[model samples]
Target chain A: MSLDDLYQSIILDHNRRPRNQGPLEGADREVHGHNPLCGDQVTIRLKMDGTTITDVRFEGSGCAISRASASMMTSAVKGRTTAQALTLFDNFHELVTGAPPAGTKLDGNAGTPGMSNASGESTDVKMPRELAAFAGVARFPLRVKCASMAWHALREALVG
Target chain B: MHRSDFPLLAASPGLHYLDSAATTQKPAVVLDAMREFYETSNANPHRGAYELSGRATDRYQAARERVARFFGLGDPDCLIFTRGTTEALNLVAQAWGRRELEPRDEVVITAMDHHANFVPWQQIAIATGARLRICELTPDGRLDMDHMRELIGPRTRVVAFPHVSNALGTVNPVADIVALARDAGALTVCDGAQAAPHMPVHFDTLGVDLYAFSGHKICGPMGIGGLLGRRTVLESLPPWQHGGDMIQVVQDEFSSWNVLPHKFEAGTPNVADAVGLAAAVEYVDGIGLDTILAHERHLLALATDRLAAMDGLTIYGPPAAERSGVLSFTMADVHPHDLATILDADGVCIRAGHHCAQPLMRRLHVPATARASFYLYNDESDVDALMRGLQRAAALFAVAGSASD
Candidate 1:
């Protein structure tokens, strides 16, 4: 695909004007990620209400891919149940890593189109579905690590 | 360097190839040897009673002997084939480091060592609980010999440093460093990855405990390299890997490993690539090392002179720095990646970023650098293309930065 497809307008918008930024101190969990390839660094924070994610924010120094991904992730998962949020993480990870569940079409929205909404309603968030834009990103091998750095660091925080 | 000998030189759209420090282009002779091997005696080495195996084994052993003679060693027994410099260093880490290392015993390493040399020691140190002490580098990328002298005391058991820095391209005085390391009673390991490709290397002259160099970097085939250590050193280290070929006898309760080279080499090795490497080394030998070193020095002097003249440029290393072809530099405000991208657009292949030397990169106080390395194959035209590429990078990045603003 072209740069236009990879750096879609929405991704660029998130990169240019990130949604949740700066430090979130007193956060239940905080994680920092670094991509040595392009020298991208990010610090993500999860402010939780008991076991649920009450708020999520991040601050980092990185390229467009990492910054946009972090912003999108925090916005998508804030106020999510820890377990529910983890499922979203697993799904998004599969799309980026090319290990999608069997019988799932390669199309971006073929399986489980969007993340669950807070009202217990399901809205088809295009940003979450746009993750397949990174499926091609994974094929490069080196860039796969760059795309996955944020989620990997998040997992480290929750687990460790 | 003559372009007629190399077809890639004729095919690449333009010049400014500074990545030979990573890997050099194959000479006409090296290519011919590979072709001759495949066309004539392509067979598994040390396996069957056939003319092909005999010829193949002859070619493979000749390469080992060639390496032994090239390093002025007494026997080919000292030369062990490995994947590359990384594995060679790691072999010592596994074989020697595993046996001798004890808790609280230390491996004295230099900060300037390439990660290949650094990480293996780090891992082995972690596994053995042998502490790791690093000798720092001067701002000019020279090993702080004083620091090495101090750090490598009686407690220090191993000392590792590159004979030449792959990133800064500063050539170290191995003989001098080895003397100090030896005085401290630590076995010295020198990384010859950048050294062997550019200049003549004689391990006997350096007198280090172990010296490792890769074939691919010297226009040889990939997957073939040499680990030159004294036979006694080899004897002391345990066989860290195991399987067929490396063994002598196997019983229900006990097994014995093979001798010297085969003990280290546990399986069917890269027969073809080993033959190809033998050829590559022979090609270098026929050219005469004096001619090769002179050609590289002449090209390096010219290229570094051209780069030193650029405006707003910051070249890392001393003026008249004891350098090989690898030259790392930075330009005002233009990131190395941006510079590399612009140069790539003009078909100039150069290495950007940390060169896998993160600590050294941090020492330079920059995110990364644009590196232009030279090889014997590169000529004035290639260096000129690099100069033009840098100029293009400066202008285009300047324009792009302003336009983005």
Candidate 2:
């Protein structure tokens, strides 16, 4: 019963009907990320319009957290600049891992300011509401990798 | 069951541990033996000249003798102590494989083997320019004997396989396979990491040229294991590691290696864990290996029956009669990782991954599986808890208006 915090309705919904869940046709950049420990793999494909990600899609098989994260990630990063998506990755990472990416500040615009962390205390950077469903991942340390599998692939695809 | 003998199981009344294939819980006797060794005979073995060092050497030698006797080996000098099965296999692969295998030589392995048994041979094959051939598995998860007979030929120099598959729990016919290798003039290396714990394993009877097993998997302490090699085979290879203990004469330009087991065991050996492993062997012997095997078979049957009756679950491996003590499966809607998490919430521990048999998982067409392995400590209640937890995972993922909905 206590697993409700980790597996929210919205997350499960996205997992059941994943958006952008197939290979993107005419995609310019594609990157595959796999966690050899769990065998969770995510392939992120992007159709980049200059510096802007005009279209994004994913293809892979994994747990609900990873699948749903990839589903929500595609919708969240579509039509966004490469810089904005990287910023969102930082915020999403901090939300689940309880720590921001090393050597980078969480510049505003990833979430609503002054949102509460898992302990009901206000945090410096807030997470987008849909991504906030994964904040409970911080409690279950092992699932953090599952939550961030897609985000890591996206970061790799963008930077490379 | 002998659950009470293990301190951790005795302390945690609510824990239902089904992950013995990863490593078993150490009993109090094994712990006490290590503590006793440290308290009384604490000194570096084979070096010190004082009385304490003599006692330490005696303890270490006595452990080797106990281990040799337990595994039905005639010569204790053939047993080389290692950190675990990984190191032992690496030693064989590096020392024997590098020296014996020529560019056109062939090495045979099975697809269902754990990476410990598979990778070392792969690396050695690459290093030596030898051909690495893998024996395929049957649909029921047993090794395809036809494929094996085809792979092992005149050029096959070394054949390595697991006695019991860590992922599928398929118990291999060790002596039969060893005979095939012998007929082909190839040395056989058997990885007994998964088999030595739940069942009786006799090195001399198995007829394998080299055998490796881990202490932690056999309810012994970690960081200590033994590689049992034939006397002639052990003498034919070079020493794996160099330094303190494995030398006979150190010259300015060249050095001569020690004989038999000492030639393989270099540096300060893990004396205390070795003593602990011997005590573990004694404790297991006290319980009777036949009784342990029977108990685990009963548990495995119960688990298999329950899991088979479950609507959405599909169990891997051969029939319950063919398997040792492991049950690997997958649910329809829930991922293995998610299923493991749900089971853990109910204090039921199961392993969920590729189980270090990535090639086997690929052959099975599943990325990973959920495995629940039985041991001497487990009983019917543990199986019941596993069922309850699996049902919880199913309901959470499938039922309308449930948490997922």
Candidate 3:
């Protein structure tokens, strides 16, 4: 895979102008994630309105993949229910790692986020199209951690 | 100067490996020696009555002598074979630190030290109830001499520092630091992982009581390294680990430890890699460390000049004159990992991360830096490739930045 595939225009844009890049006000759940190999750190703040996440923000220093993923994560999960956010996490995990999410049977998406599976069942929680830009990360195994760092933090926040 | 000596470099003409500070590519001669040892002299040393074991014992002992001579150590007994610098340092910190340090005693290490040199002392200090004092760095990343003087005071029991900074390529003044530690009546320990490979190092003349280095960084095999220490200092410390070869005799009641180097080398040692490391030592000595140093300095100078000329790029540490072969830098708006990935696509390898020196990274005030370290195998072309890759990254980021805005 070429560099453009990993650093898609969307990724660069998100990296250049990361979205929701500060601590959420009155955050109920906050979790910090670190990639020890690359020293990429992400602190995710979520303002929970009961089960639904009303606001999400991430602040940290990371490479393009990680920072962009975190920015997109906040945008993706802001108004999502805790369960839906976890489903999205499962979908996103499969997209980058080429591995099925443990204990979560991905609906119809074949772990490809938006792509159709043989069963052709539609996933209730689909990954945002912009998040699919990280699909190429599967080819670069070392970068799977970078692409999944923020998502991992999100999962930790919601699950906890 | 001798790129062809390394088979991987010779095979892949387009590939540029700039992460030698992490581990150097071994030359053909070193590989051949290792293969020869396994093929002919593979046996457990010192246990059997067979000739092969004797041969293995001889080769392993001979390798120790060769490594000792390479470091300019007069006595081979003072050198203990370790897996790498980390193990050697841990040995000193645990064995010596535990024995000597008391509550309120101070262990001084520099901010520029790699984790191998830093964490061991920190842990030892914590375990022994001793205070760990960190010597700060100057703006250019050299050790602060005045701070060094202040840190090594009456309570200071041990002082550990790196001979060269792995992240910043800062060549520290070992003699000056040793002098301060000596005046304070503290035992001096030097981490020579970066220095042993790049330049001439005289372990005996440096006046450090203990020095640790890895073989892989010096063109030798992995899982093999050495710690050079003063014989008296090494003898005073009890064995940190107890195992097969390190014991003199095992009684039902108690056990006695083996002699100098063997007492520290617990397990059935890495004999083949030891033989291979000796071959590597011989290969490096044949090339002449002065020649290697000169060649690396030229490459460092060229890279520094070209990188400094690039827009929005910052080079860390002292100028090229004071540094060894390492060159760490960061491009504005591009994270070091991004720079590394872009460079990887161009077949120019580099190291990007905290470099296992998170304290130093905190000191530098950057999360991490992109490091393109050169070695004897590298030449002007590698630097050209690195520059080209940086330009490409800059161009891509510029377009992306404007489009996003």
Candidate 4:
């Protein structure tokens, strides 16, 4: 419940200078996500090469949690294949919602056997350490939406 | 007076509640009255021939009379008991707007109106192919009287506006707006959701065709509100809802409606909550609306001066003399949600969002604002807590800024 738990140094840094921000050119997939309760909005655009996500970017206005989550998500998913990105998304979603990283070790350890994506390949991917900074958001139930806004948009863009 | 009346406030001793515009905490007397109703006269009103039903009917009728007197409505029957201001306004839009409005007719509303007043008219206009005209606000966020004078014309069938802007706290010129609507041969529906809590509302004196106010905003229970309309106007509009209580005769193919207020109230009305609202009315009257208004004005003035002194802070709405107890503001670097969360850490509760007035937020060019609205229970100490909360949030963001450098 402490503010420090939710607004860690990493979150504030990402929010202050968000990485991979603004619009992407010739994006093959684009999606918008909004949390109507607090008016947090994010538009995610992706440039895909076959199943690989070559580049990703986001643009919008929101609270520190939302902006920082989007920045970390773009940095995590860049240069990864679509299936790996989806797996990372699943791991990140679990991390923020108070669930342990189920099938993957995101703390700089080797990956475990994970679920497979649409390509029938093992979706076990390395969880980026930076994305784990948002685990504290699970304590503040209302802010889970702020932390997951970008991931929801990324899910829609990739799966849909 | 120090939070003893409301159990929630009593439990959370250090909580600085500034979201009165959303809903006011109920007093002990209102709660007791509702409990008393259940203990003594709990029965379906106006149905059974038993003594308990008669007593229930009597209490319900008495609550209606008390509400009518509180709002200065001459005829208690002209007032309809609604779920809240939203339902009351919707009843007007459906019953009156649908029947009277035709294609090409205009329903003029201001940009300062809450969505409760704005959306219903917009939908009615769209449904009837009527033109919905939006009057602009002045630079200071007051309803632009000059713009209203121009927009209201012969074709303007209705003019619905809020007595106070929930987002900006601007106390609009109700008399002027009503005069214009009257001149154009149009009906005026005044949204009194915010106004009735902070100030005394004399519905008949306002010269409005219809006025709506919620119970929860004025220390009453939720799910109960009052809507006052002219007796002739009430008779003219058909009932928006029809069921057991609102009918006079039920035929095989056709049914006749009941008289004035009952015609609009369908099914089993919220009688216990109505009694609670009556008790709330008495509680506020005991405090004297003028005294409450003055106390709130003092708190608002102090908060406004303190907030104005802070750097990178912009306060919306008119100046202190012209506005109500609500204070909406935004800091330079902190989003309202972040600010509100930081404030909550200090037990300072303030609203942070569009205030259900998205159009007003767009007009002000802010994604959202943090609003601190005061009521009778608030004092100078509450304002001090708010100031401290703002400073803490600002300092946190300032540290974040320097860390990035």
Candidate 5:
């Protein structure tokens, strides 16, 4: 799909029932993120195994890009190993930052190795290429924080 | 749309300014008054004794008298000129909070207070080794009266909060809250920042021991505001800031402070801003706060109606009738920043973020929101313009991800 179509889908899905609209019961982890100027918040919850992400969910509220982004993130990162998830995180950041594909986006980074989940969805999708829908967020400098809120919350849960 | 008298209404032509809650547009009269001061009466009043000096003093003191009466204050001497609400609050925290409280004593403040009112008392409490108590508001934005009564006992020394919440637009029951604290033997401090510009806040009638307001938000010049202390409260508290024009005697070993208002005003105060504020107060008073409030309320109601009617709009703050002009919201899938940017393109300005109330945001369970705040300058046209902007923003987002479609 074109960049525009990708963005439309993201918004459509986000506007529908948002992923993790409310908190999960008996969840392993929960962390909060907020933007102080306009008062938006989101909390992240992750159920992880020894070396694999067992289940990933988000429970919170925010604008379209953020809520939808969290939904997409939950979809994209689940069942992936920690190292692969980190690479996807890096690619997502690079995509929003508009970095050249010469490094990560262009290469068959996921296919050359065993980067698929139990469902066999390739972990090698350089999210920047697919997630390029959020590039418009980069055009508006202030919205960058909205896109980053979930990512930041997720990073805290994992690295900690 | 824009008030003709306000220069900043269309200051950046086609600029949709939604940050009035932060500050407001300055009217031409306020600007002229300030310019008139600098051009004609540049002499320092109260300190200098010349022709121009006397003229300056006359106008300056007259402005003070005007503000005193505006808030139902009888004596201008009871009014202390400060930088703005922040400074006014800090002065009280230092002069009263420090001098009065014991190490284990407590000061009760709501969770919704702006940092200006919240932090000063916190610092003062820290300095005095006094404790700072939090009186969290209920989910619906009212002060928890039961919690308040439970909190303010003998150990509690003062109760401070905003008359209207800057974030929630909650018009707290000031008289009731003040009475509660007063009966508990505690001083009452009310930050009038959010309330003063939107409504007629009578300091004397509010019965708050100390009332603070900034001039800028009320279409006055920046850097000038006042603190109205009860006559008895003014008499008990020592002036916090010390310098020229605030001293009765300056001996080699020690110095004695001057009386009342001047004692609180140190150095060369914001004289020009004071003149502008006075002019602003006169303008609001002349227009009748009834009209200003009625107009703003109408605009707020119109905006909220249009927004709440939208397919995916979720709004924050009080109900349209209960809240003032501030309307915070988020579209179904559009982040507030994205909404604001798209709105900006449509020549509508708005503020997107936490609005300086992080705690309130946590309670609302959302990060950042698009806030279309109305003011005296905003009219029905602006509200309609915002409605159009929202439609445009939704349309823009609707077509965003079509990479190849």
Candidate 6:
């Protein structure tokens, strides 16, 4: 609702110095996404070995929210499998769009729908704490697109 | 002008509305006229045989006449009521562009035009297999007339440009462009959406084949605008939309069109909004367009000086003397969306985006810019509020950086 809530220190730091900010060599897939409304654009590249994402990177020019989201997404999904990365993307998207986590009781799923932790406990129906910084985006409807721009490209890069 | 004359401004006291280039706040007189029309004559014009319908028809036609006189058109019938400038431009593209353009023909448009003026021509060119050529802008955002001259050749079928840029507020050289188009035997379509509200527009003297302007940008109701064209040119083109009221006689398979303006207008028109637009025209005329232009220029000068004095701020567009009432700028390391959000918290409304001119954004090498536009209602205090809001955003960002460090 306020600027402080949306522009958290974590978001600003990632925007200032994004991780994996450039191209990924010998990538398996590369996809581009752009928000025509604000002219924010991101190109996401991925390197997949079998069903596992070995590396991921992105490059673009946009607002702090979009840049930070892209930087955070690349860092979160780099070492995870394709399936795990996609699930994480879904959880992050829901967190920013104000939707309940996917495959939760509210989503009418019989079983939890996320990856297991080291203790073999199901961590479904909860967004990773790192992505909680973006929860404020839901209040500013116009900025939801900024938070989701990179994830959209990631979805396309993985699926298509 | 007293802000109390506008109901919305009166209700939202201390609200700084700097987005008038996007749409102006409506005056009480225009609102009252529209309400009175609905209360007194609610019948469908040119439909019923009763006196109410006759009165409605008279009122609608009288609106057309008033709009014509406001734009300096001799024949009211040459002006056709439309949904807005976008629809008017689309009408020209579909009706005129489809018929006149052919394969290998060129339709020249500028890089600074709003999407309403750019996209319709681009679509028409694609449909007809004609080439869509774009005129570039100078480094300072003015239209590159030399490049425009080079682009307008014998194959150019039409030249469409904006009278004033919605994004950069660059006042184009209309007479020169019109003369070049005429010499090249190309029809000229001037998108006057930004011009009519800020200055006096004479459609006939401009020598354009067609001119389009919206009502909402001129302090009138939305969903209404006017397209002024020469009688011969309007009659030559086929009807863009086919429906009731635009047909003279219809068989099971064939139909003949109506007269000049009516042929372009299909179905029941926006009668109430048209009446509101007429009232808007009268209201501005009462204040004198020249005076409004001067007031806006003064505001623009004051705002430009203040913005220029700011650290790490870059203002877009030509100088104040050459432009209208728009001021687009960018602050150091701060996105326009962030600036707009900060300004909104202080009750200052501004537009921060490509302003529907993405091509110009690319030309400027910026993703987007924050724009503050002035109108009749905006004064010096509004500009001061904008500056204060921007300063607050800068201070916040600076503090956040230092805290993180």
- Identify the leading candidate in terms of DockQ: 3
lDDT by residue for model 2 (B70-161), tens: 89899999999999999999999998888888899999999998999899999999999999999999999999998999999999998999
Query: Residue by residue across A58-84, what tens digits does model 4's lDDT show?
Result: 999999999999999999999887777
CAPRI classification of candidate 5: acceptable
lDDT of 6 by residue, A1-160 (tens): 6878888888887877788999888988999999988888999999988767799999998888999999999988877765566667767767888774544222232125554544343434334577889988888888999999998899778767
Interface RMSD of each: 5.1, 2.9, 0.7, 0.9, 6.3, 1.5
- In candidate 6, stretches whose alpha carbon ends up further than 4 angstroms from where it belongs are A101-127, B403-405
The interface RMSD value for candidate 4 stands at 0.9
Pull out the clashing pairs in model 3. none
lDDT score of residue B352 within candidate 2: 96
> Candidates 2 and 4: which is better by DockQ?
4
Complex DockQ per candidate: 0.14, 0.46, 0.81, 0.75, 0.25, 0.58
> Which digits, one per residue and each the tens of the lDDT, describe model 4 over residues B36-116?
999999999999999999999999999999999999898999989999999999999999988999998999998988999
Ordered list by DockQ, greatest first: 3, 4, 6, 2, 5, 1
Per-prediction TM-score, please?
Answer: 0.81, 0.96, 0.96, 0.97, 0.77, 0.94
Candidate 6 per-residue lDDT over residues B187-274, each given as its tens digit? 9999999999999998888899999999999999999998999999998999999998999999999999999788988999889999
What is the per-residue lDDT of model 3 for residues B1-405, given as tens digits with 9 covering 90 to 100? 689999999999889999999999999999999999999999999888999999999999999999999999999999999999999999999888888889999999999989999999999888989999999999988999999888889899889999999999999888888888889999999999999999989988889999999999999999999899988898988999999988998999999999988899888889999999999999999989999899999999999999999999999999998999999999999999999999999899999999999999998999999999988889999999999999999998999999978
Off by over 4 Å in 3: A106-123
Compared with the real two-chain complex, what DockQ does model 5 have? 0.25
DockQ (0 to 1) for model 4: 0.75
Q: Model 6's lDDT to the true fold?
A: 0.89
True contacts kept of 5: 0.53
Which scores higher on lDDT, 1 or 4? 4
Give the worst 10-residue stretch by lDDT in candidate 2 chain B. B396-405
Best by TM-score: 4
lDDT of 5 by residue, B1-405 (tens): 337787766566566666788889888999999999999988888877689988888888988998888888888899998889999999899999778988989999988788898788888888989999988778777678888888988888899988888876778888788888988899999999888888888777778999999998888888989899898999889879789999999999999988888889888777788889999999888888878778878888888888888988987766778887678787876777667766777678888877766666666777666788878777777787898889987776656434313
Evaluate all candidate structures by whole-model CA lDDT and list the values in order: 0.76, 0.90, 0.90, 0.90, 0.78, 0.89
Per residue, candidate 1 scores C-alpha lDDT tens digits across B256-357 of 988988899988877777777877777777777778777777777787788888888998865433788777888875557546655665677888777878
Per-model chain A TM: 0.75, 0.85, 0.87, 0.88, 0.73, 0.85
Candidate 2 regions exceeding 4 Å error are A106-127, B400-405
